[model samples]
Target chain A: MINLQPYENPMYFGYLLIGLLPIIIGMLYEKRFRWYETLFSFCFLVLIFDGPKLGQGIALIGYTIFEVLLTWGYVRYRTRPKGANKTSIFVLAVILSIAPLVVVKFTPLFDPQHPSIFGFLGISYLTFKVVGMIMETRDGMIKEFNILKFLQFLLFFPTISSGPIDRYRRFIKDYDRVPTKEKYLELLEKGVHYVMIGFLYKFILGYFFGTLLLPNIEKIALINGHSNVLGLSWSLVGVMYAYSMYLFFDFAGYSLFAVGISYIMGIQTPINFNKPFASWNIKEFWNRWHMTLSFWFRDYIYMRFVFFMIKHKVLKSRIAIANLGYVVLFLIMGIWHGETWYYIVYGLFHATVMILTDAWLRFKKKHPDLLPSNRFTKVMSVVLTFHVVCFSFLIFSGFLDKLWFGFR
Target chain B: MDNVRETVLEILSDLTGSDEIKANPDINLFETGLLDSMGTVQLLLELQAQLDVDAPVSEFDRTEWATPNKVVAKVESMQ
Candidate 1:
């Protein structure tokens, strides 16, 4: 009857560390305790989906079966001797992989109070994994289908709720081998460091920014902006910065916990953030912020879009094609976040900025003297990019919708 | 095979807009900022168009195709 959300509290880490000890010990002895690791993952998964969340647990089971079968089927088709790779079939498989997530995302629009039957925590992340697998299979990159390994990857407890989204091949390599003692010792050191940093970011700074400060700031902003013209006030700027900090600390902290725990288990799950605020441009920000997700969007969505455009000769100009790809990528990203106007706007805003940044870079290349590369310019770029990103975050935060139209 | 290498190096240079790819065939294109996700796409498209080497975008792994020499080898192997 015990239900636990991932990294929900200090107690979760206590349980996690205790559960990881056996695997850690086994790794130290140059053994991968796969059975025990599987057992630990199941137990933790149960804790996450038990009690009042039993429906979601059931949903997750059904969803896992569905994805596993879909991936297996696709791989089998692709790898079959004399199999003809049909575009329609590949497209259908990808669509099927995303169907549940689409339904889950759209459910709220139809019924505000009721959760979708297909919905589960981390469904989006799971969908990303399945879609990635399907795409790889299509590309002839994923030629083998191992159902058990697929299950393990999909159900990896540490990153189940959210992810630094591990790739199939990258994950399997780590899963199949026990790291050398020295390497594991290093992993242990870094893992411990990351978890400690996560604690500071999530429990301390995240708490201070999100829990302690956000509500008060929001209240003040609402009060001051409610009567102001177009509900605009300086207090809203306070809301923007506070929300941005909270978003970064809270999510980055959660990501660190995921990555650290994966490290402890001998899986080198990718890091999600890399000093994102230091980015000099919107394009660079995507590279640093929630890196795995952005990279996913980049590789699977953006790159593919550009390739499709070029292959089909949809646009004559490469620049125009690149610009259109950004629009398509960000628009899809926005819709994936949810069916909201602000989210769409946030997507378009990023798309426009990315295009402009590309144009500026090209122009700067053409006229290097106009914008000299100095420390001052570098600082200015970062400062400007940070505020631009913060403004996007404000739009993402949905405070504006509330400020303007009183919808939270 | 030499033609494949030369062609791939030319494509890399064109896509990156830098002759450094040819100058240092072993340089990490990704790490050195010479090639990126978009650049990778362009490279694949150019390769497909020029050499008739049908390398899918998804098959373009960074680790496997990190350098001009490796890319040339990959193209040759595919051929």
Candidate 2:
């Protein structure tokens, strides 16, 4: 049986307080600080304190504080009214947020013995959030920042780890004042439901599949050896299913817990999953699964790359450049996931599939009258997409080594 | 005679695999299922590529890209 005790980290309460500190600080400094600015400072301080080591913590906290202050200072120098210098602020924020990720990913080369870096808690998610906020501010979508509101927006605990990737504009508009007695009661009830579902998925379904089904199938494959080809094939397929189930249960569980907590707090965070397994194509699958992250890539990475390609006139052909952009975007995505050749290959694989699918659709469009509207095609697309995703996951899980090394 | 309209129409025709662009100037891209959110990104890229313009894709809200009229207006301004 899995141990629940490990989940109860002693620092858990401290982390919650750290998450809430920004809001409190923002409220207290309402006169001088924009609510969001105060919250940002609080978050910076918390991040510094929460660092794995004193030196690393001090450096990260100092860097973030300096960046935030520098950004605010630049805005102030412009002498523009509240939301006017949004573009400059956003540019600075993105650069600053991305700096930590770049340093961490590259640090392994310098210190191989201690490959792990310190002081980053949900840096990936924070980078996305900060970028999204800056973009929204630049677009003139958000006018004013309240410190408490800003803190609540940034450090909403549920999303701090493995986020549903909330956008700032959407979140701010959706968030209301904290709940009253009746509202709190309703939130508590819903929060309990979500927590129950999350716990069941993680403890029951995920654990059972990981412990029982995966091991049993592996054993069966080993016993049968190459003598029973059908058994081996079935075992591989079973392993894929187990992996897929584990991912869904794990992520969906986290999202449910986040949503439930937010709802009680009077925030209506958008639903993250929508039966992604039922998607009919790669395009549909992207729409359904990890919707927020996909959207982020679309908005910030893919679209920008496409625009840049068009602007530079480097490629004579638009379609060719667009296809290349997709590959580049996915490759960046792979690198973002981790520093591994497997990740790069996995990214390239998905990018190739997505590009080919898109090209096929384009071709079909040109000769539509020649094509038939058949259910078989749809079914085939769905099956192919699922396999593609599963294969990518296999690569992600570092299982291709087993295939190449003869299953020792 | 403006290539802007023709270019957009060609792109739309290619995307939807239908010659409906010539038939309707005021068709709702989303409601008619010609362009979902992904399609919108594709369309923006196509417009930038063909038109040689730098229209910020972020600024192209759904309401603005819903019809040919708005699309034409947005493209013209960017040019």
Candidate 3:
């Protein structure tokens, strides 16, 4: 009867913390109770998906079973070392693992009224994990698979909805051992701090930017829609900053909670944000912002593409290969977001910026004397990068879609 | 040995953008964030270009070739 969306409000945080009390105590005593962790994950998952959202809950269960069986089958075959793992077969398995998520994402494009039955909250994030595991297994990075461990990794409650997507090996290392009390105390200290920061970000500042101000700003931006050649206006600028702030605080706040809880459980899940706003260039920005997700993309998508291109002699130069990889990577990211013109444009925008950034960095490398390396220039770069990122977020906001369609 | 150390230092410095990078055999480049999988790719490419130590990317893991010294040894073994 107790159906709760995870971290939906301040009250949800209280409930979560209260529920985590036992785990906190267990970690303090230097004991990692795996069974207890599993039990809590299940209960909280139920709270999130039962009741009105029971359809999603059921979908999650079926989807998990499919993924686990698929991964198990792949790992068993891979472990044999002499198995004929054909590329086409492996590709089919990957597609099968992603089938549910792909349907969930694109179902509404053709028929908005009938969403896919397999759809559920966190499907995209979970698919990322499943697909990642399959690829890593194909590469022989994961030697053997255990069903329970695979399930636990996929359903790791805190990061299930959205992730600082943890790697399989990195996760196993943390889950398999209990930290010493001294180290756990350190973890606890950081955990508490992260949660406090999260409260400020999500509950306080996010409410101000998203709940209190965004709607009013949207009204103004709409009113001034046709005042410029590109339909840009001063009010539109406000929407950009407000929306970017809201996005950062809300998402980063969720990541902090996930990471904080993982720490309390002695799982040291990776951090997601690292002062993303302070980055000096687009490459550095990717390194800092939603770090786990970007790194996942880098490792699984971008890096693999580049490696494949080089190995097969698909491109002439290293630079060309990297550039092509960036385009394909960001375009896929945009598509993964949703099948919308704005999202696709947003992806192309980032790809262009990165390509330009690479060129500039190469040029700067050659002519270090031409571009002054003063604090002023550094500040200018940060400010410019910040605006560039904000403008991209504006495209991502789909305000243009609303504007062009004359939606009030 | 000296040539390998110099080659390692050159690759490490370029990737990290640190002019002061030292060729300390014990220093773990991965832990220091100077090298990751992408950097590993770069290092492998550089090694082939400079020293002709070629190996399949599938055959290597980051943890095995985590440090500069290990990387040097890996390249040497391949040769």
Candidate 4:
């Protein structure tokens, strides 16, 4: 049994202070707080008290209340005639979505262990999805929402933990239609399969490979370096391949399990992956990989950035504009991932590679006759892209210090 | 001369990487696999660039541009 003594952590009192005060102030002033804004405040209170048990309880209660309020507010707001004022709402939603990310990402600098300031559990995913929904509503891509549905969307338990990054339209449409008994059975079966897959990946594959295989291989490579550069490179590549596969299965398995559970609960969630490794190009890989997250970025972030650039005359020259747009998009992406210089570098590295690859493809298309149509180029591009992706992952693992200091 | 049909067919060929445009003038773009959402965006950009006409992206209707014939007609009307 888990120890309950930690529940008495002083942090609980801090959370009580941080969580309740703003809520009271907001209520007194009748100022609206976005769902995440309210949750963040509560998380702060929990962090102050250092009571994980109390924090968890408060988080559950707080989220339920926030969901209900947001849902009700959404319904009431939707009843008003469409107007130009939606732009302000969209902007507000964007800021609220990005706020938690900023706080959590930066918190490691102040307190690296807990990082409770940002409220890690599902806040990032929910914030992005909520922001996307607001954007979709403003863009007229989705019909106005009702309160209960909105609440359900926010606090939908299966996806609340780890998401397939559902879209508002898809979620609402599926929610409105009740699934048949047969469908429930089918979904339950799928859910079980997903749970099994998640367990296998997380416990068997990820743990075993990471603990049993990687360290020994690394040790061998370290001892024989320089004399066995090729061997070391190949081994490193193998390790990366294992890491990449582990990450995909672990995350994707969680998403699949979430979707399966939701499906069994009579909510039809969208699939998040479609054989990303089979992709022929980086663009295709992105399209097939972490589809929901990428789509969220595309719909709400990338497209918005592109439109802003176009409107502001920042995209005057083709090459300059493409590069600039990519940098901006990836920088935001980096910030979204975390506040560390490592993530920033990770984002910039991808942006640079994507831009250069795009430029090269454009050039090749323009001068088809001059370009080599050999199998070697195609093979090389795939190999190079894979290595580039692996290197980025290394930076993400926070092992740059080790790389620099030669410390094992 | 079938100017609208010819222009659309040429554009479709480029997009689908096909020499022949098998799509019917009245068929839905989605039904014919001629356009998905990404393809639709690409088509819009191409149309704006090639025809020097502004299409309000905000007002884009899937049904209105569901077919090459409808798209061509829309462009012609705009012209």
State the lDDT of candidate 1 residue by residue for A135-250, as single tens digits.
88898989999888999998998898988798998899999988999999999999988998998999889999999998898998988986867777888899999999999999
Best first by TM-score, ranked: 1, 3, 2, 4
Taking the candidates in order, what DockQ does each have?
0.78, 0.25, 0.28, 0.19
In model 3, what is the error at residue A196, expressed in angstroms?
Answer: 1.0
lDDT of 2 by residue, B29-77 (tens): 7655567544666677788778976655667666777887668877888
lDDT (10s digit) by residue, model 4, range A1-408: 122221133453244335445533443343424464436533443443344455544554554465445534543464466544366665765565556556656787788787563363666677777776656556555556666566667666556656777777777777666455555556556755765675676556766766677677666554554454233455566656666766776677667766655654445787787777765456656667788787666656665565555556665764565567668777888877887778899889878877877777666667769857578876776676666676777666554434344643
Q: List candidate 1 segments past 4 Å from native.
A: B23-34, B63-70, B73-79
TM-score of each: 0.96, 0.73, 0.90, 0.71
Name the runs in model 3 displaced over 4 angstroms. Answer: A81-85, B1-40, B45-79
Q: Candidate 4's interface RMSD, please?
A: 4.5
Best by lDDT: 1
In model 2, which regions exceed 4 Å deviation? A1-67, A70-93, A115-117, A136-149, A176-196, A215-234, A369-371, A402-408, B1-33, B36-55, B60-79
Best-fitting candidate, measured by TM-score?
Answer: 1
Q: Candidate 2 residues A1-408, lDDT tens each?
A: 111111233354245445444543433332223455445445534543453444554654454564455434443434455435654555766677677667777787677666444435555776677666555555445445555555556666556656778876668765654445565556557765876787787667877776767777655544554665333566666677777777777777667766765554445666677788777667667767887788788788777667656557777776787788778878988998877777888889888887887788677767878667789876786788888788777677554445444557
Off by over 4 Å in 4: A1-53, A56-79, A181-189, A218-235, A369-384, A406-408, B1-79
Q: Model 4: which docking level applies?
A: incorrect
Mind giving the per-residue lDDT tens digits that candidate 3 earns over A1-408? 877777777667777888788888888888877787888888889988999999999999999989888988888887885865778868888999989988888898989898888988899889988888888788767888988888888899888888879878878888888889999999899988888888888888888999999989999988888776577888989999999999999989888888987887788899999998988888889888988888778877887787777767887797888888889889999999899999999999999999998888778767879988899999999999999999999999988788777644
